[model samples]
Target: MQAPMTAYKRAWGEASAKLIRKELEKVRQEGDFSEERIAAALRRLGCGRDHGVHLGHGFYSVHTGVACVSGRVAKDEVTSKVHGAYAEPQPGTGPCVENRGGH
Candidate 1:
């Protein structure tokens, strides 16, 4: 049997914030929404203007207890305030990615 992919999945299918940062660099978009256009979006998300890390096509920031990336996959996609945009992530919902601070 196979597990279904959930929205909780990272944009590039990786869990490490470091790895996702690498993949984010390859994304590119048209004018206006260019790689440099993430600042405003970050501010709009209340993540602050300084937290923005323009990664070609999205904005990313990792703080003490929060991480976020904003985007528009396509014009046809519904644009909305997507806090916790994926879903409520619960422990035991899937396999562990990294055992952080575990004894």
Candidate 2:
């Protein structure tokens, strides 16, 4: 069994995911899939600094205060999800697993 989720964790997890989705939408609209541009869009979530935000191989993983938000970004489409304490390992060379503290 797993420990109960803290209120803080639950709140931040949702908030971070929501922000990630919005930023990814901007990414789709902007047509700039560079790491710098994506990171800039997610700046409001306090990514790209202490909390790591890794972007590569068409995938991105951001370690927020309470959860890891991972996503795929394309020139015309973007998708995201908030990782739980132990999400399944992501394929390829993406940082989702590590960023989520899974490995």
Expressed as tens digits, the lDDT of each residue in 36-86 for candidate 1 is 544443433343324433233332432212333333423233121112222
Q: How many residue pairs clash in each candidate?
A: 0, 0
Per-residue lDDT tens digits for candidate 2, residues 1-103, read: 1123477776786788787888778877878888778878878656775665677766777766566677789976788766544344444323345423244
TM-score of 1: 0.27
lDDT of 2 at 78: 86
Worst 10-residue lDDT window, candidate 2: 92-101
Please give the lDDT score for candidate 2.
Answer: 0.67
Q: lDDT of all predictions, in order shown?
A: 0.32, 0.67
Who wins the lDDT comparison? 2
- Cα RMSD of all models vs. native, in order, equals 12.2, 4.8
Candidate 1: regions farther than 4 A off: 1-31, 48-54, 58-64, 67-72, 78-103
Error of 2 at 51 (Å): 1.0
lDDT of 1 at 73: 28
Residue pairs that clash (backbone atoms under 3 angstroms), model 2? none
